[model samples]
Target: MIRHLGLCLLLLAAFWVTPTAKAATVCTATSTPMIFPQAGPTQVDSNAVVTVTCNTFGLSLLATARVRMCLNLDGGSVAPAQIVPRRMQNSFGDPLNFQLYSNPAHTVIWGGSAAPGVPAAVQIDLEYGVPVLGGAGTATTTIYGRVPAQSGLAAGTFTNSFAAANAVLTYRYSEALLATPPWPTSCLAGGNGGASTGFPFTASAPVASRCTISTATDLDFGNVPGAIATNRDQTSAVTFTCTGRTAWNVGLDNGIHAAGTTRRMRLGTSANYVRYELYRDAGHSQRWGTTAGTDTASGTGSGGAQTVTVQGRVPAGQMVPAGTYADTVTVTITY
Candidate 1:
C-alpha cells in the first residue's frame, strides 16, 4: 500500500511539471442593424457596421487567426435568385423593393454562396503578439442598403424577420497559433464556416404621400348688361401637382347656394339666385360634380402640374338681380 501511494504521488508531480499546448483562440461577431428611409427616387441608402473580435491567451510567440462571416437569410416572398432585386415584407405581407451592398458606393452586390450570383462569405485576417493574457482585437466592415423606386407602397415597418423567421449570421475561425493567412474576396455575403447565431436587425421605411392643390384662378365674369343677348361664358383653371402615379380626385362642392347638385350664384344678402353650372368638357356635356370617379376629375399623377379646365356659363335672358354676381365653390382633392 505504501509503495502504491508513493507511485501515485510521483505521477501527480510529473503531470503538474509537464507543459501542455497553449490555449486555442476564440472569436465573436456582432452587427449594428440598419434602417432605410422612405424616398420616391429609384435609389436610397442606409448603413450598418459588422464587427469581429478575436482573443488570445498569454503566449510567448506571436499568434494569428483567420476569420470568416456569411449570412443565412430567411426565405422571403421573393426568391433567393431575386436577391439583386430584394423585397422586404410588411405585416400585411406587402413587399417593398430593396437591396444590400458591400460598399457605400453600392457597386458590389452583397450576397452569400447559398445565394447564386451573390458573394459566398467575408473574411477577417488577424495577427497579434502576446505577453498579455487573453487580449482582444477587433475588425469592422460596413454594410450598405438601398430601396429602389417603386410605383407605390403603403406606409409601414418592413423587416427580414417576422413570425418565427430569422436572418442568421455564421462565424468561422481557425485555431489560434496559425501563420499569417491570406484574405478571401469571393466569400463575403454567403455563410462560409464557423459558429453561428441570430443576427437581429430592423429594416423600415415610412411612406408619406404628398399633393398640392391651387384654386388661385377663380371664374370671373365682367359686369353683365341689363339685357342678356346670349349665354355669357367664362373659363378658369384648377391646377395641381402630386407624386408620381398617386391616384387623386378633385371634387367641386355645391356653391353657397344649395339646391342639391344644381349649381347657382346668389345675391350678397337676399335669397334671390341666378342658375349657373360647371362643366369639365368644352361642350358642357360632362357636368363636374362632387362624386369621386363618377362626376369628379380623376387622374393618376405624373409628379407635375396638371390643369383641369372649369367652364362656366350664364343662360341668356334671366333678368335677375344685378349687384355683384359670384359663387364660392369648395374644391377638395382626395388622394
Candidate 2:
C-alpha cells in the first residue's frame, strides 16, 4: 500500500510538471500597405490586408487553444490627439487628412493603438493536430481607409508610415479540451494572460493636377437693327476649376461659319455672312484664337473657380439683308 501511494505521488508530480498548451503560444502578424489611386476633391478609399497567426505546440489530439486578440492602428506620421481622423504629410510639410476604419461601411473608426478608441478584436482557434494550419490559427482582416473630400493646395505624394508600435496586435489566450464551453471574450478579458506584437505598414497616395471646365453662356449680341453701321460689342464669361499651381491656357475656335480664319455669322444656312470677331481683352486688342501659344489666355490656377472673359465684336461695315444671324464657337483649354 505504501508503494502504491508512492506511485500515485509520482504520477501527480509528473502531471504538475507538464507544460500547458498556452506556454508554447507565440503570435506574429504581417500586412500589406494601403495604397490609393490619384486623389481629387472627392473622398478616396483604400484597403490593407492584415493577418495574425498564433501557434500552439506540443498538444495532444483534440486539444484546442483559443485566443482573444485586439488589433489597433495609431495615428500615422501625422500625430493627432485622436487616432480616428489621422493625417499624412507631403515632402513640403503640407497635410492631407484621412482615417482608418474597422468595418467596410467605414462607420467604425480603427484606433486603440494606445487607448480610448475601440481596438479591432478577433477570436482564434488553434487545434494542435489540425493539419489545416499545422497546429496554428490565423485571422485575416481588411482595414478600410479613407481620405475625405478636401481642397488641395498642390499636387504631390502624401504618405504615412506605421511602425515602432503604430500598428499593434495584442492578444490573450488559454488552452482547453475540444469540449471546453468557454474562452476569453476579448483581448483584455483573460486578465494577465496577454502579450503584444507589432507589424509595420504604410499609407501613400498622389494627388494629380485636375481641372474641369464648366459651361458658360453664349455670346448674344442682342438684335442688330437695320444695316451694319457701327461696331457691336458683347461679353460672356467662361469658368474653370483646377488644382492650385496648375497652369492653363484658354482658347477660342473659329465659329462653324468662318471665311479663312475670319469668324463670321451665318444668315439662316444661306451664302450671306456677317463679319464678327472674338477677343481676349475688354479693349478688344488681343484677338482670341485656337492657337494655344499665341492667342490663348493663360493663367495659373488657385484651386478655385476662375473666369475668362470672352469678348465679341461685330465690326459693322458689311452689306447684308436684315435677318437673324448666329454663330457657335468652341472653347478649349490647354495645360
Candidate 3:
C-alpha cells in the first residue's frame, strides 16, 4: 500500500512539472481608413496603414507569431466576397465598384483575414515576427485600395463604414515556443502607441461638365412685296439646355447668300435673290451674326432648357426673285 501511494505521488509530481500550453495573446491595433479623392475614367489607387502592437508583458513569451488582417466590406450592406468589383454604397443606395488589395502590386487577396469565427473577412498575412522586441512589439501593414472608372456615379462623397458591418479591420495571431526572427529596419525600435478602431474610408468623384444643343429652327417670311413696298417679318426659336452657371454663346453664321453682313435669300434653283436680314430686337436692329457677345446671344445657364428667338425681316422691296425664296443658316454654340 505504501508503494502504491508512492507511485501515485510520482504521477502527481510529473503532472505538476509538465508545462501547460496557453491560449495565444491578442495585441492592440489601430488603423486609419483609406481615402480616395474624386475618381475618373481611369483607375484611382490609394494606400493606408494599420499598426498592430503588443504589450511588453507577453511579448517576450511569444516565440514565433503569425498574423492575418481581414477586411469586411458591405458597401453599406453585406458583401458577397472580398475580390475586385467590391461595391460601395451611397446615401441614395447607389453602388460604386472598387477593390481592396493585399499588396502594393495588388496581386494577392486579403479576403477573410479576421478572427477564426468570422467568415466574411478578407485577410492578408504580414511578415513574421512583426513585433520583434518584447517591450513594445509593433508592426505596420499597408492596405492597397483602388476605385476603378466610375464616371457614371454622381458627383459627391461616397463612403463605407467600418464600425458595425461594412468595412472593419480584424486580426488574429498564433505563436510558438521558438524565438522570433530579427525585426525589419523599418519597424525596429518602433511600436504602435495609440488605440485602434475599425478602419473606414471614403471614395469620391467630380462629375464632368456636360452641355447640349438642339436642332435648328427655320425662319421664313412668306410672300413678300417686291419693289420696296412694305416690310415682312417672321419669327422662329431654338431651344438649348445646359448645366447651371455655365457660360454659353449662340452664334448664327452668314446665310448661303450673305455678302459681308448683307443678308439675302436666293430663289429656288435660280441665281436671282431677295434681300432680307436677321435681327435680335424688335426694331429691326442688332443684327445677329457669328461674333460672340456682340452679334450672338450670350447667357449664363440655369440648368434648364432655354429658348432664344430669331427675328427675320424682308425689308420693303428687294427687287429680283419671282419664285420661292429660301436661306440656310448654321447655328453654333460655344460653352
* Best-matching candidate per TM-score: 2
Candidate numbers sorted by lDDT from highest down: 2, 1, 3
Give lDDT tens digits, candidate 1, residues 110-198. 65455555554444455444433555667777778788876545445666641112445555444233344443332233212345555
lDDT of each: 0.64, 0.77, 0.60
Summarize candidate 2's per-residue lDDT along 272-335 as a digit string, tens digits.
Answer: 8899899988999999997777999998877788999899999978778888888888888887
Q: Which candidate has the top score in lDDT?
A: 2
Better of 1 and 2 by TM-score: 2
CA lDDT, candidate 3, residue 320: 72
Between which residue pairs do clashes occur in model 2? none
Superposed Cα RMSD, model 3: 10.4
Write model 3 residue lDDT over 1-335, tens digit each, in one string: 45544444444443444332233445555557778766645678877676666433344344455444444444444244334466665555455677766668876544543345433444445544423344335677776788886444533355654443345555544444454433222211222221223555443433333446775578867665556587888888978875545678888888888877788788777787878888887887888888887889888665567788989888885567467878888888887
- Per-residue lDDT, model 1, residue 87, is 72
lDDT: worst 10-residue window of model 3: 187-196
Each candidate structure's TM-score, on Cα atoms with residue i matched to residue i, is 0.57, 0.74, 0.53
lDDT of 2 at 186: 67
Better by TM-score, candidate 3 or 2: 2
Poorly placed runs, candidate 3 (over 4 Å): 1-58, 61-210, 225-228
